[model samples]
Each structure stands twice: as C-alpha cells, then as structure tokens.
Target: SFDVGGKEAPKVQLTKDGKEVKFTSVEGTRHVYSIAEVKPEHQGVYKLTAKNKTSSEETTVTLNVTGMYIIQ
Candidate 1:
C-alpha cells in the first residue's frame, strides 16, 4: 500500500500490454500507481508502481503462472 496527497500524487492507472485496469476511482494515474493485469500473455518482468498526486515508484517483478499439461 502507498500514501499520497490528494492533489499531489498521480491518480495511477494499471494495465496489461495496453489494456486498461482501473485500480482507483481517481484520475491521472500515470507513473504513480502500480497497476497491471497478469495474464497468459504477461510472461516476463512487469512494472509495479504506486502513485498519488505527490510521488510515485518504479519497480519490476516477474510473473509466473503454472499451467496444466495437455496430454495427447
């Protein structure tokens, strides 16, 4: 979790490969909020952030989701 001023930090927006995933009811969620939707296509280092109207963070994370084997 993060704390930011109401009019300081960015409203923060999350997405996966350009898909919008709203994390908050606020707007201007740019490099502020840590937002992303993990999907089968999302296999690699992802960006994680948290922002408000004040300040934001920039980080990276690896997403690993196992899948069932498909037998012939």
Candidate 2:
C-alpha cells in the first residue's frame, strides 16, 4: 500500500474464499506489491478491498465450483 497522500485505493487486496490471489498492477502514483496467491481450496466469494490511509471501500464477487458426473 502507498503511504502517500492524494492516492486513493493505494492498495488493492484480492482474496478468494478468505485466501489471497494474484492481481495485475493498475495505474498508481507509485509501485505496489501483490497481496498473495489463492489456494486450491479458495473457491467461492472473491472479495476485493481497496483502501488508503483515509477511508476504505470493499467489493465482492461470487464464484461457483462444479464437478462432472459422467455415467457409463
């Protein structure tokens, strides 16, 4: 996260089912680091939290997993 002013969403933390995920860097005043990686078990709601020193905002996305049941 950027510790500088005039920068909103200084850091974007991406998580999948309470686990970290990879994300590309967006335009920003300075360089930012990646949060982490999403584990295999992390299959569900994906939440993204962007925040600065001031206030913070949040967003979430749903992800459903499926399996194949082929009959012979």
lDDT by residue for model 1 over 15-38, one digit each (tens)?
Answer: 544455444444333233333664
State the displacement of the C-alpha of residue 8, model 2, in Å, after optimal TM-score superposition. 3.9
Q: Summarize candidate 2's per-residue lDDT along 1-72 as a digit string, tens digits.
A: 332334454566777778877655545444344436544454578777767788777777775546657999
Model 1 TM-score, 2 decimals? 0.36
- Model 1 error, position 40 (Å): 2.6
Candidate with best TM-score:
2
Worst 10 residues of 1 by lDDT: 26-35
| TM-score against truth, every candidate | 0.36, 0.54
Residue 57 of candidate 1: its Cα lDDT?
64
